[model samples]
Target: MKRRPRRTIPATLTALVLLAACVLVAIVAIQLAIGRTPIISYRSVTGTLHSIHWNDTAPLIAGGTCALLGLLLLLAALLPGRPTVLPLTGDMDAGVTRRSLRHALQNTAATVDGVTRAKLKLGRRTIVARIRTDRTNTAGLTDAVRGALDQRLDQVAPLNRPAMKIQLRATRNAP
Candidate 1:
């Protein structure tokens, strides 16, 4: 089945815009509050505070510009991108790792005597396994898969067994 794509936040641009807005607002507000009018000269501004003439407005301007850029970047990140089945390289490491572990669990489930197929999924600290089997009595197979997988995975990744999910599907090929 085709899976829907996922959307995520854009970080870089968002940071730039937020940083620019904060610093610029601070500088402008501080200068205005102190009753100082800056003199603009060729991409620079100069102002005086406390009887001291600061000749460089470049820092303030640069900071403000960076804030604006940061804001714009933040906005750009909010834009939606095409959906994808695979997660982007952002904050999905834990989820991906869980998926890998779940796949492993499913493989283990399929190794049972009567099991025909198995699917597994991992969430947070739990592993869920679904098994399709052809046996009339599934209790034994269920217990076996659970015990075996729990022991095996615990030795490797240490997952919670109580949270494990097992779904058994009975098939017609029972011996």
Candidate 2:
């Protein structure tokens, strides 16, 4: 059987809140069954056959709060999860996992002159390469990284060519 995707954090929290509320209600019902009043102050309207009326302002505020919470939770649940793979070739199965892509990009960036360390973030339409370098000529380093990335990417020729962005972090000492 196909299992549903895991709930997002907000959805999980909402579900937990609902469960806790049901448990609280059950506790109150049990207390009433045993002929004991709940610890909280409340008139037994049903038992006394009294009509209950909700004041406009309080009810409206409460209803609006509930509506907003529901909408927020729905939005959270609908948002897409983090992408795990990047397609590198036209073949359906030819792809690299996000981790592999990061490693590969880092390795490629490390090939650039004066780059001591490289970190890469692969976004939907951009490959952001953050590099630590000892060289002060950041503009030249950026262009070099971009050229290396272009060559590396051309080797695979991914279906979508996400633009490369190079960010340099100058290091005090050369590695």
Candidate 3:
């Protein structure tokens, strides 16, 4: 099962907008209590609201814009994000990061005999291991790498284990 991401971005933006509105209201109220002219003129705003009828184009446009913005924010908050970690199978709840799991697989393949370097890509359907070997004849190197990786995977025991693929590149010995 995939993990759900936290709605940090949407939540933070909404909180900041609400905070700014609250601060503006509080500042206006404080100015009014001290009998000072507010930074925003209340009389002008009241007159503008009174003048804007329901059928006015300006009001309709402003209301439509606000509704669209609200819907966008709601969708952003509700949508799910990509899972960062792959789930591991165990008695307890456990998971491994994608980077770490890929690194572990590469390291396992590299530990095999005659393998000089190893790079691995883990995807939804396949885990591809690209290895560079010093040995000229790579007859059984593929199986060896596959066996080593399978053993390591058995230890890790992930819920979704993909099929493995090996690509070999051998460097001929220089005289």
- Candidate topping lDDT: 3
Instruction: Count backbone overlaps in model 3.
Output: 0
Q: Tell me the TM-score of model 2.
A: 0.72
Model 2 agreement with the true structure over 47-166: per-residue lDDT tens digits: 433453465566678889999998987876787665565666664566666677677778999987789999898887899999898775566888888898898888867767888788
lDDT against the true structure, per candidate, is: 0.61, 0.76, 0.89
| Pick by TM-score: 1 or 2, better one | 2
User: Cα deviation of 167 in candidate 3 (Å)?
Assistant: 9.7
lDDT, model 1, position 70? 70
Model 2 residue 170 distance off true place after TM-score fit, in angstroms? 3.8
The C-alpha TM-scores of every prediction are: 0.43, 0.72, 0.64
Scored against the true structure, residue 141 in model 1 reaches a CA lDDT of 80
Per-residue CA lDDT of candidate 1, range 1-175, in tens?
Answer: 1133332344544557789878876777777678776332312432333334335676577778879877876656565443222232333332224455556667777877888998876654456677887778676888888887877666444322337767777886446
Positional deviation of 117 in candidate 3, in angstroms?
9.1
List runs of model 2 lying over 4 Å from the truth: 1-7, 41-55, 79-82, 137-139, 154-157, 169-175
Order of models, best lDDT first: 3, 2, 1
* Model 3, span 36-83: residue lDDT tens: 999888999999999889999998999999999899888987776656
**Predicted model with the maximum TM-score:** 2
